[model samples]
Target: MKNIFKLSILGLGLALTLASCSPEDPIGSKVTYYPLITVNGDDFMSVEEGGTFNDPGAVATIGDEEVPVTTTYEGRFRGQTYNSTLGTSVADLYTASYAATNEDGFDGVATRTIYVGNTGDLVTSIEGLYRSTVTRNGALTAQYTDMEYVLIWKNSDGTYEISDAFGGYYDLGRAYGVGYITPGGVIVANDIPTNNFSFPGTQYNSGFGAPSEITAMTVDPATNSIDLTVVWTTTTTYTFQIHLDQVQL
Candidate 1:
């Protein structure tokens, strides 16, 4: 009976080991590897407004073997849609995406961003009311929150206008005058969003200087947020950054 029990335990262990074993692949079977996609040119391209654009496509590969890549593009240019056409008129933002599929039904994808505009113009669309966050010297400055409120939109004359040029930091008087009065604003700001011919900010008034100048402005592509920096006689040393988040378009 003791010998029989030992033999039974050994047989169970062997059975478990056999069940856990993986079957070997047939001879000459190929191993599957996912494709790696690499874009050909610059990930971001700056094409002039109303200029001709030719897309330099991307490439995909599995190990050293090259695979066929399928490419598609979508752009924002005066509400125009073109997936294969090369003409780009007016200021626009385009995303060209490349995709490849392997035999095992695995897909690899990559994209390129194209900004179409003339030099020194707003690249992407920013015409709308914005939820603004003003930061001075890396610290949140909420005092001028009211005056810092900004609105930007297009005009019939094909120009742009901003509510406040300073973006924020003045107009310490939302209620009554305490520190300073609201500074006057800019009338003719920049180009239109369609032609990259204009500016930012469509409403409100803030800042100490009578005319707050927008020294620099840019949009962060990743967050789809616009950042504006303003400087004036009162705040000449450093400028406050107003991060504009779109509230209404």
Candidate 2:
């Protein structure tokens, strides 16, 4: 009976040791994993008004294999009419959705945003008052600085106009005559006025001294900002850069 009892205890100890040596349950044994869907390429895009939209395509992945996905786009011009009081045309916000489901019945989704507008209507899109910072010789100086507000509007002849009050010598207003949009979406000023000098609010002539020209200009709709490189002749030829922030009002 003693020997039998000792053998039973020995068997129980061996069973416990074998259980401890067994491998752990497989990783994520109780968790369910779903396929991951990723939309490739630029999620945001632009299209000309009345133009067809082309999908950039997307991909869905399940484990190590690629799965089929469906992509769809829907857009409408939210504001179709122009507000004369506001001097701005309504913008069209476009949206696209991508969706996919794996064989295991898990679904994934992605989305995109787009802007649709007329190709040459930048003048209307950018008509408003803007806060500007003019940097000359890599520094902010009192002379030739119009750091407050600049006005931009669409002219009757379909060109764009920019008015920078106190932008010229002796605090005279600098009126940029007319600006047109290039095929590449750049805004080029027709010519810089050399003799235009007037105090904006007081109607006083401050007298202009030299000629200035806007050498280059670019607009970024994403940031609501305009960057300009302007060249002017004074005692010496000087180049300045203007960074403008569009004011909502």
Candidate 3:
């Protein structure tokens, strides 16, 4: 049995060597050491509305040798779409990527998140933790009960930007996840106006339609909840209802 085990180990090592060795190498050699990038500041960073963003940048190294890194501040979610000047008075999400290329022409990249939000009186009044649920086409899509996974906070002139807009769906309802929030404009008589919001990993049928039929949009902390109706896969009928129930800050 011991001899059999040794033979198996020898066979596995041979297979690994054969897999690793290339025609050019003729030996099992690791790929060229690429530069590793590290972002300097917090992975999740924010800039208040009407404020400026100054990236702390990043560093790159190949072992002990320093290597040049290429950095970018993306203003849009769709790849590297860069707008001339990033607007501050809107609920916008962005990304910061640091990349270092090796001599072998391979790229090593690191990514972080950026949120543009407002810390206004109206926002503070409505920001809190909550029970949550989401539905598409009148069918349940997601929910959270025992744990208060829904968090809504912050604001902007064009939209009130917060943690998670999907409650607990697209990003586990975490602020630092792949999700961000945008409830647009100022509130008058506690009426939430129509707004368009988009997030990652969703393929909506048409455009992300308006949040038209809001059942309960309020600023009262004790019994605060939001019932938002949006058009989803079946366009025009307002087929999606995502809500923040029993809000508590």
Candidate 4:
């Protein structure tokens, strides 16, 4: 096993802090991560500032190009003894081919290349069917997996929603809304036209607290990772850097 240690997208300072000795969070010892997006060669896309894009790599450039980086060893699951490997390939959400490797000593990797244009040539990779492979001893088995609920940003309402009802749940007059609650027990979705709401009286189904703001959303040009940053209020904030490849199924 390689002593791989890198920083989480949370912050460079946080990464460094974790790299040294961290007791606040036991998971801090991990440094390497599976990139949510990655790039190779001419395939690329342009993302709006604050929008989310997914890919892999250490750094993302402005042109949607990702700098390729490698892990010393495969990543392990939360509590599993297995190590999983990810890669860039042609099989992807939009189009590309790649696969993740597991126990069989086979290289598990996947990749997809996209094109970017100034005006009409802009393109992005999307997700496709879920594919899985299992190998025991020397035998390999394949399985088709169903997708889980995907969280989406609603442009019209300027809120977010996570759904699992196969698209029919939100088709009617019901949709989940997110917000922040004030220390005084008031909940509101900033800039949204609805009144302060709660689980029963709210327009949407989800509420955090008040003063939460969308911090940063962008695509790294180097790794094509979709990074998100949000400030729940004056005192609390959250950031996420994710690669699209991790969303398989």
User: Each model's RMSD to truth, in Å?
Assistant: 13.5, 14.9, 12.6, 26.3
If both were scored by TM-score, which would come out higher, candidate 1 or candidate 4?
1
What is the C-alpha lDDT profile of model 4 across 165-215, one tens digit per residue?
111122211233112111111122342222222211212212433343333
TM per model? 0.42, 0.35, 0.52, 0.20
Q: Which stretches in model 1 have alpha-carbon errors above 4 Å? A: 1-30, 75-81, 85-87, 120-157, 161-249
lDDT of 2 by residue, 191-248 (tens): 3222112111112122444555655666676667767666556678666677777754
Winning model by lDDT: 1
lDDT of 3 at 72: 66
Question: Mind sharing the TM-score for model 3?
Answer: 0.52
lDDT of 1 by residue, 1-249 (tens): 999999999999999999889688777877888989999888877566567777788889998999998877675323445555545663445677788999899899998877655432234444544456666656664465534235555445645444445453443314333233323333343432433333333222332334445656665544555677765444345456777765421
User: Per-model C-alpha lDDT, please?
Assistant: 0.57, 0.51, 0.52, 0.27
Across 79-161, the per-residue lDDT of candidate 3 in tens digits comes to 33434344455434566778888888888999877765433333234443456676656666333332344444443333333
Q: Is candidate 3 or candidate 4 better by lDDT?
A: 3
Best by TM-score: 3
- Model 3 ranges with Cα > 4 A deviation: 1-31, 76-90, 123-132, 136-216, 222-225, 231-239, 245-249
Residue 21 in model 2: shift from native, Å? Answer: 99
